[model samples]
Target: MTGLAKPQGVKRMQVVIHAGAAFTDDGRLLGSLLANKAALAQSRSLPLGPRHSRQFVKVMSDSVIKDVPVDDAQEDLREIFPEDLNAERLIISSDKFFGPRRTALQHGQIYPFAAKRTAYSEKLLEGAQLELFVGLVNPGSFIPKILMSLHEDQRESILGSTDLSCLSWLNMIDDLGDLAPGVKLTLWENEDTPLIWGDIVRAMAGLADDVALKDEYALLLSLLTGTGKTQLLELIQQGTAKDRQSLRDSLAGIFEDHAQPEQIEEELDLPGWNSDIVSAFSELYEQDLAKIHTMPNVRVLHP
Candidate 1:
């Protein structure tokens, strides 16, 4: 694709779409990034582009806020992005792209998300420079969350029929390809939030490799209380990289020691799911994560 046209002689704009694999981000990525844009730019945490917040908002809104008529999208883009603004990239972050997160029945069937099969069919960023970034969670946790969102009516028809054992998050992600053909897709497991949080921010910004970043630890600060990250940092600081098992062990210990007791606990009020079922589901979740790590063209961001 030639990319979204800019002014007569301006540079092409890079667009990043953070299509949510729900129950993942919880708004921290966009919230913290936008809040610190000014300071971040000063420190060169992200690639510098349109420096003004107003200009930045325009770029994001036009791409994600509402429908930009298929016929006039190019014209609309030119208006939203003035060449003089020198916008380096546009980012549209949304969980709504695929529709509400829900499943009427269990047994591994995810509902309505199929509509997302064509969600990007409009080619919202058709001619523009575009990149798609998605976060995924194992069906173990994801399936339950979708059930929680169900209304009274939906609960019976949908939640009543779910069998958590048969869920597959990989299938959902793989489906995106057929819907939005030929798009460059990047996949990262949300379960690794703490370790790869910085990478996520950097990747989204389309920043350079050498740009020294400040506040890299800011994302974890909230989740990891005092002394919570010490051991993990020490392990990472060691000359040799640790194995997956060791890393997981260190992180689990640190988080257990530092995480707020209440925060770590979950209350899944769904029927047919007691602590045992949940634990089994969680075990399966870990297995799914392992499988995801091996997929081709899908980048798994780890420490």
Candidate 2:
């Protein structure tokens, strides 16, 4: 008996196990089971039997266990376990590994949805913060609500209605609307943009007196254009005699510089010249004098 063929003396061991997380598909669950079995076999020093050997019986059961539908795993595992015996392990470790892994998978799958909810919450918080800041700054006023109610384009329109210099004061209101708590120091400091309309008015008044009328006129024209100058002149033309006299004095230098010298000589000699020359000169003088008188404030030059 030449040892009844040495292979016949080798005892084949077999075990079966089932384990998985709730959402494990068949292939993944099978892979997990094989991995667990390999780990157990490596630890226990067992020669694993073939996965489909009829000599093996199901030794473990779980919700995750199901018959293999196709031959992919069989082909892959053929070389590793050639003996006709199926081996498996208890699914306890498999269940433990997959439980949390399954939960993590589920969480990752729905992560986008959770992120959207977080973003919406952040926007709501931002709105609440903005509202609270506005309330604190305005105290008794409802300007913040009014600003919020307006469309973006309308906000600029409303701002335009107020003076440009007042923008920094308005920004104080805006800062209060959106600023953090420690930013109070910004309010205590003076801004380059002025806050008071009265200051602008006083400056304009000073310019009105200290600057020459032409300079004032040019300044006004530069700021407001030719139509504004025409309107201002029309208004002055409608004023009382005293007001007109003052305007005339302010404007007299302009008119005198533009008057004709021939007209001046003719007007001075008006009552006693040769008739022909006198008539011709008289007509010319009359026309020129009329032109000068129509100006703001030219005086006749005497000879």
Candidate 3:
């Protein structure tokens, strides 16, 4: 990463930061990850981290969200997290860095939402010792949520001015690359988050496979039906304990058979789309993800 380097005497430092492509994380991942604090204490690979992780990050990066002066922020933050803090890494997340995502504003397909704002946030964080993590969603469902949340007139204005048919988030990711070169990027599809919840938390915390990520199954439980969850647990324990890959295969089979119809259904009940168009947009999104996987120094989280 292109930021302040740690002194030789200190452990080489790293920071894991998640600035959401809005509506993706919603702070739940952070909540679930922090729940592992007790087990994390016993983890050998994970480093000792900030005592109040969420608070420390929020306080230090509040300027990035609120658009305050970076210089003032640097001075004030040092007071709160003096050099004596023993943490080698920090787990930070915020959705606000991308600006108001659910607004009645659209800037067209090529430059849809938060392009400039995201670049600005990166600029604000310039020279900060941190790596970047982001969750991207398909514009297929993303647009509906934004329209639903806005005033009718505002929504109309956005629809009138923007070409939703060609929307893509590749530009936004590219914007980050242009603005913050040398920063490590970790990516995952928002829709697949439940399947890879444990993996995401472990990667974000810079922990090893053995360091358990608490509430790893929390997202799956919320998304799956009661029968599915029970069946999955049974499959996991029915025979002798299975390897991670075997367990994952068993879980996937269960999920495929029993995933709730409502969870799979994407009924916007709003305008500007049909089943075919939505499907096409979704395919395009998958393609975008495939392209992202090919980028150098980028970590694409998987199940």
Candidate 4:
């Protein structure tokens, strides 16, 4: 005996949350998705822009902090995403979802509150499917970037007693899986983003196999030399690299010859961080990435 009869057999919405671990996309990914917003809408997926995503984050944060019930949180979301929404999938991209970048290294851990925040995000999803997409960077570069983003006083406070070697993306992933169960987690290396950007966009936008978006190679092209860019574009135009793997394979060869090393290489200069430490962090990162490749409840997208 309800006030209004429920609609029969309507599909549930699927929510894709891009929870940044920071300095990964730097808003570029969202920018790329926004570029294809028209196409995305045609495919029944709405990529929430920065304003909408901020509103969503604020609503979820208030609910989590104020102990607001799930129903109330959902009602708040309805204001942002109307009940008559025409999309089957909603995409929200925000690095802040992992917490502020300044607190990234707190308690000797990377994104210590990621799992908890993710759980809160899930609570507001109502009946929709939730997918968490996280982009991870090597702590060698990741730590330096984080420090550079913080003020002098804030850096030391966040790095309190933290052993840099102890930071592991694998651990963060495990925590996300254990603490935020029932949500699919998709991961890719920031280093490999140039190669796999197409797949990432498709997954985030919930695009069908035949639905193609423009500028999938924008990142890859930026790092390419003049000739490299020409050949890569020609390869795509001529159907040489017809699929994701084939394109990746072709791009790898081109990168060897035409990638601008200066653009591809990240210059690292920070207090107490040297070549040796960076190398060690990189080695550990590779090892962790290998282990993550085999983990359950996770999908690791590779170049």
Give lDDT per model, in order: 0.58, 0.27, 0.64, 0.82
Off by over 4 Å in 1: 1-3, 6-12, 38-69, 72-85, 102-122, 160-164, 209-214, 229-253
- Across 1-303, the per-residue lDDT of candidate 4 in tens digits comes to 011112568676788999876878889889988999988888788888899898888888777778998777877776567756777788899998878787688776888878887887776775677899989899999998888889988877766667767887766777888888988999999888888888889888887755777898888899999999999899878987667677778888887789999988888767788989999998999899888888877888887
Give the least accurate 10-residue stretch of model 4, judged by summed lDDT.
1-10
TM-score list, all predictions: 0.71, 0.14, 0.80, 0.92
- Per-residue lDDT tens digits for candidate 3, residues 1-303, read 223235667555555667676667667876775678655544322322334444444544466557677666555455434565455565556654454554423565533334444444344444445577777778777777767777888777877878777678777667667766656788888877877777777877777876656567767766678999887667645854367777667767777788888876667756756777778988999898889889886788876
User: lDDT at 265 for candidate 2?
Assistant: 29
Candidate 1 accuracy as TM-score: 0.71
Off by over 4 Å in 2: 1-14, 18-69, 84-303
Write down the worst ten-residue block by lDDT for model 1.
44-53
Q: Which stretches of candidate 4 lie over 4 Å from their true place?
A: 1-8, 242-244
Instruction: Tell me the tens digit of each residue's lDDT in model 2 across 143-211.
Output: 222334456666456544543212112223232224333111111111101111112211212222222
Report the CA-based lDDT of candidate 4 relative to the real structure. Answer: 0.82
TM-score of 3: 0.80
Candidate 1: pairs in clash: 4-128, 104-158, 106-161, 106-162, 107-163
Error of 4 at 160 (Å): 2.9
Of 1 and 2, the candidate ahead on lDDT is 1
lDDT of 1 by residue, 1-303 (tens): 133555556654566666677767776677656755764454333332333323333443454436655555445455444555434666656654454554323436553453343344335455456566778765556666777777767766664466557776666656655665455577777766765666677777766543445565554545776576665566556824356556555665676578765654566777766777777877877787787778775666665
